[model samples]
Target chain A: MTTAVLFDNVSRHFGVVRAVDRVNLDIAEGEFFAMLGPSGSGKTTCLRLMAGFEQPTGGHIEIFGETAEGVPPYRRSVNTVFQDYALFPHLSTLDNVAYGLMVKGAGREERRKAAEDALAMVKLPGYGTRRPGQLSGGQRQRVALARALVNKPKVLLLDEPLGALDLKLREQMQEELKSLQKSLGITFVFVTHDQGEALSMADRIAVFNEGRIQQLGRPEEVYNQPKTRFVADFVGSSNVLSTKLCQRLGVKAAFASLRPEAIALAAPSNGALSLAGTIAGQSFLGATNRVVVDVDGARIAVASPAAHAVPAIGSPVTISFAARDLHPMEDA
Target chain B: MRSEKSNRAPLSLKIAAAAGLAFMHLPILLIFLYAFTTEEKSYQFPPPGLTTQWFGVAWDRPDVWAALALSVKVASIATATALVLGTLCAAAISQTRFFGRETISLLVILPIALPGIITGIALRSAFSMADIPFSFWTIVLGHATFCIVVVYNNAVARFRRISGSLIEASMDLGADGFQTFRYVILPNIGTALLAGGMLAFALSFDEVIVTTFTAGQQSTLPIWMLEELIRPRQRPVTNVVAMIVVVVTFLPILGAYYLTRDGDQIAGASK
Candidate 1:
């Protein structure tokens, strides 16, 4: 697979603050990639750099094998769906969608036809004449998508596009966006702080913390095989055991993390590392029960099936998991 | 309880509000009332009869036409100048950060904040020191000083309300800087600039003190009206001309008020 976007040791510093530290990354062509992080983690900065909204302070950035350094946003072959939608309020929905074509100096009739087609692709056909102010939040988001896609750029960068929507709408849009990206075969780079959204939609996820990518891999790889303590704590609810505790279990590693799902509430007949502890808390989470066990002063969480019997809080119990389930993690 | 409170505005407050409105507008109403009065000399209450002959008289006078023409010319020129300079100033202050931005903004608005008489005196002294002769352009320049403030006030408020993301989105969608401005920034601030221009026109139309200092032997509508008031020739005709000025100035102010009246929201950025 060819690399669509490459950031080789790219860094952006705003005075004393390093917003995006020197980072190397590659996004393959036609891949659905996500930059996931909390606010101030520099995920948005990376997306902006790709869009040419910001120039890297050091190192190099290439888009589709061409250097993107010192290029203005209009000159780049990348489009962005801003977090706030940012549709043109003064123009009709059709006009807003056709803006890119107009800027590119296309004929009026041709741009209008393409804009309408793009709108239909986003499932908002015949929404041409209405002003952006008249549309609902979801409709406006679709308009923003239509506007970005009208240009048919090499990469589409979405900066938390569904952040303003309600939970139900966000989930629905996520499905639509994924399907759209698949059909278009255009590389989609989505930046968001919502881990669930990133995990559910993106084929690959980059977990970022403090201006650095802690880990980057497929969703399951990042979640199940986290390489750092930061990633293990961030990607999913994993209990990271201290190095001293791991030595007690005969594992020679700086730190070991175990997923809640990997931990069994009952002792296994097969040889498995077991820890006896008292149930500190148990909460029902639909299909699963999250049971927090106090084991040797460390609270290890175990995700038990909701159908099974749950021990009362403060009750003594033993949780067991196979040795292979514990994954070694680097101290970040 | 809410209905009762809203329905019964306190009697004293109602009276006070009515009194305040009458105090402000009664003089203008009197100007309209006296326009039709048959009385040609001295102050008269409830005149013996009313006639429309003064309207005919005011219409026939060449001086009245000349003054009206000059007033329109000066206001038009001033408004145009204000539209360009004020908007440019507002954009610079609003869209970019620079040292002393706040101070420059204060200075831009300082012309309108100062008393008109002081502004007039200052312009007069400065003009005399510079050995510049007072003429049509001087009045236009004098009016533009404050007209620019009016435009800047409206333009700056609208500029600040515009979201920065809209500009970025335009650029990201393959629009150059000029294209983004024409397609995004201009539409957002168009109504505000138009309203500011209208207000500036109205202000310059009826201006007298600054015109008095800057106009050397030229008589704009207000200056003409002042001379007619002091010298007392065809007094009812002067009242008729005054009525025309009142209507001409009032219409633009009203237009400006409505244009900017729910202007907090720009086109696409409205919540």
Candidate 2:
């Protein structure tokens, strides 16, 4: 497989603050790659660098193995679906999609045909004459997709494309986007702050923090085996046990991550490590109950099925987990 | 009962509002009233008679036609100049960051913010120092100073409202800078530019104080109206021209109001 986008020690500094630090990454062609981080964590900045909207203060970038640092956005073979949709309000939906073709000097009739086909691909057929303002939030997103996909860029950069939608629509669009990317056979580099979105959509996830990638791996590896404290805490909220806490739990690793769902409150298992802790609080999560327990002054959370009875607050309980579920990570 | 009470203003407040409006507009309406009056020379609350004869007389006067022609020409040229210069200044101020950007924006709008007499005096002194003749072009140059401010204000507000992503999205879709401007920026700011141009045209059409200083010998419509008021030739004819001027200026102002009222609907504006 060829490398679609390569970031070789890319660094973008805004005065004293390094927005994107010396970050190295290789995104394989036709892969659904996600750069996931919180606000100001530089995930968005990295996407901007890829889109050619921002230049790195120091580094080299390649798109499809061609040098891409100084090339303006119009010259690059990449298109972006901006978070705000960015459909032209003045133009009809058809015209907004056809804008790229029109600017490239395509014949009017030919561009119209292509724009219509692109709209149809996004399941927005016969929406040509309608303006963006007339469409719903979901429809506007489809139009934005059609506008970008019409160009058939070598790499498509999606900047939180479904960030504006409600939960139901966001999930529906997430599935649609995954299938669409597969059918198109195009590499997608998606940037989002929501880890669930990154986990569900991306083939490979790069967890970013403080302007650097903390971990780069598949969703399962990143979730099941986080390499750093930041990744463990940030992705799926794994409990990062310090060296002292690990000792209390009979774990030899200096630092380890234990998932909330992996811990169970039960009448102690014979072969599992068990700890006595009082239930400090419990929150209702729809499918599960999150119980925060204080065990030897270390606050650990356990997710139990909501159908299961939750012990009253201040009630002592034993939380147990097997050795296989405890994963080790670096302190940082 | 509560809904009805909330919907209607008190009678005293309604009368006060009506009084304020009449105080401002009644005199202008009287000008429209007297334009068709038969009284030839003097003010009368209720006219001695009514006739359409003064409009014909105003139409026949060569000086009236000359002043009207000069006024139209100056306003058109001034509005056109303001549209170009004002749009360029607005684009620079709103689109990019540089040293003294806010200061430059303030200076561009300073001409209109100052009193008309101060601007007029400054222009006259500058023209004299430069040895430039006071003519039609001088009057246009004077009008353009304030006209550019009107265009700049409207264009800048709309420019700030336009999302920068629209421009970036345009470029990412294979549009060069010029193409991005044509496809994205221009269309988003189109209504604002039109409204700004209309307001500039209206302001320049009936301008008087600055024209008084710059027009050494030339008399625009407003200057001619002032001359006619002081040295009365036919009072009703002056009123006829005044009535026509009010209508001419009011139409564009009304058009501008309606055009920008729905401006919040512009895409990229909300975000």
Using TM-score, give the best candidate's number. Answer: 1
lDDT of 2: 0.92
Q: What is the TM-score of chain B in candidate 1?
A: 0.94
What ranges in model 1 sit over 4 Å off? Answer: A268-271, B10-16, B262-271
Candidate 2: stretches off by over 4 Å: A247-253, A264-289, A304-324, B2-18, B37-41, B44-53, B262-271
Worst 10 residues of 1 chain A by lDDT: A267-276
Q: After superposition, how far is residue B167 of candidate 2 from its true place, in Å?
A: 1.9
Q: Highest lDDT among the candidates is held by which one?
A: 2
Best by DockQ: 1
Model 1: docking quality category = medium
Reproduced native contacts, each prediction: 0.83, 0.78
- DockQ, 0 to 1 scale, candidate 2: 0.49
> What TM value does the first chain of each candidate achieve?
0.98, 0.97
Q: In candidate 1, what are the lDDT values of residues B1-271, reduced to their tens digit?
A: 9998899989999999999999999988888888898888855898778999999998899999999999999999999999999999999999889999999999999999999999999999999999999999999999999999999999998898778888999999888988888888888898899899999999999999988999998999998988898775678888899888888998998988887874555543454
How do the residues A45-66 of candidate 2 rate in per-residue lDDT, one tens digit apiece?
Answer: 9999999999999989999999
RMSD in Å for model 1: 2.3
- For B20-65, candidate 2 gives per-residue lDDT tens digits of 9999999988888989888777877699999999988998999999
Which lDDT values do the candidates have, in the order given?
0.91, 0.92
